[model samples]
Target: MSILLVEDEAPKRKNIRSLLEQMDLLGLVSEACSVGSAIRSLRSSSFDLILLDMSLPTFDIVAGESGGRAQGFGGVEVLRYMDRFKLPTAVIVVTAYPAFSQGDKEIDLTELGKNLEAQHPKIFRGIVFYNSMFSTWRDELKTKIEEVIIR
Candidate 1:
């Protein structure tokens, strides 16, 4: 299956790509490092699944520059874009953050997951909490990917 991985951090993105390669599920994998790049990719190609990072920069950072504003709900914005265009791609949010601020209110990952599933049921598959120090996230991600593959 074709997959789009949207992650701003190079290390995390490399880890995810390595995991997918190890799992032998790296079919037509594409990478996007920011909200703008992700959206541009979405507009240009069709993906069977999207592994998204919740927090992301508004645009990609150049090699020698780093002044772009970050968006706490960048993945959510991608989902909104999918919903708006009625894209049928399944999404699995992979984030390192435990909580995020929505306007003035801070919501935990659980609430955010529930809200995302409820609001974008058509494309939202699940959320996986990722920590480089832990292996549980890898297992959870494997399970989620298998579930999506089965469906």
Candidate 2:
């Protein structure tokens, strides 16, 4: 299966790619460092899965400015675009807000997930947090991927 990985941080993206490779599921994997890049990649090719990050320091190619990180929903816009165009790719949101580093000011993303599902059902397969600082994150991600693949 093909996969599109959307993330901003270089090291994080590298780590995820390594994990995907180790899992033996890295078939035709593509990377996008920003929202604009992700959009461009999607427009050019079709993917079976999209691994997304919520907060991104995206650069808008058209606007020549920042895209969604300030408003704190970069992945939301990408999802909306996919819905608008009826892209038939499955999405899995992986984030690290309010859980690992947010301290006391962490925002609950479940509501956002619910809203997305309400607006566009069946596109989002799962939502997983980036608790990868610890040891179990790899296993969790693997499980989620396996679950999605089976579906």
Candidate 3:
């Protein structure tokens, strides 16, 4: 499967990429560190799944400066960009947002799952994959790929 992983953290990004490599599933995994880069990559190629981060720091340079905005947001903007720009790609919110109140030293994947379901019910093909801090990328992902490809 062609997987596009969009993340901004070094550790989490490396961990997930390593996991994919270990699982022999990094064949078509494209890495993007921000929403803009991911959007550009999406415009150039097609991917089967998009592993998105819920918190992204996007920028818009207007002049010689190399900065725009450093907001603590992610997937919501990415989705909004996709819809506004008419980019056709499936996304999976693999975030650690609902895992806590945004970095409070606590975790709650269950609540995250419920919120994902409620907000993304129409996106049935999307997977609310666990946060980057939460390890374990199983061969079950391969199974899911098979099911999706077959359909």
RMSD of each: 1.3, 4.1, 4.9
Candidate achieving higher lDDT, 1 or 2: 1
Candidate 2 residue-wise lDDT, 22-87, digit = tens: 988776688886777888888999998899887766663235655545425778778988988899
For candidate 2, what is the lDDT?
Answer: 0.77
Which tens-of-lDDT digit does each residue in 13-129 have in candidate 1?
A: 988998999889776799998888999999999999999999999889987867288888888889999999999999999999989887889999899999998999999999999
lDDT of 2 at 103: 46
Q: Report, for every candidate in turn, its global Cα lDDT versus the true structure.
A: 0.92, 0.77, 0.64
For each candidate, what TM-score against the reference? Answer: 0.95, 0.82, 0.66
TM-score of 3: 0.66
- Each model's total of backbone clashes: 0, 1, 2
Worst 10 residues of 1 by lDDT: 63-72
| Candidate 3 collision pairs | 56-73, 56-74
Best by TM-score: 1
Model 3, position 33: C-alpha lDDT score: 68
Task: Return the candidate ranking by TM-score, descending.
Answer: 1, 2, 3
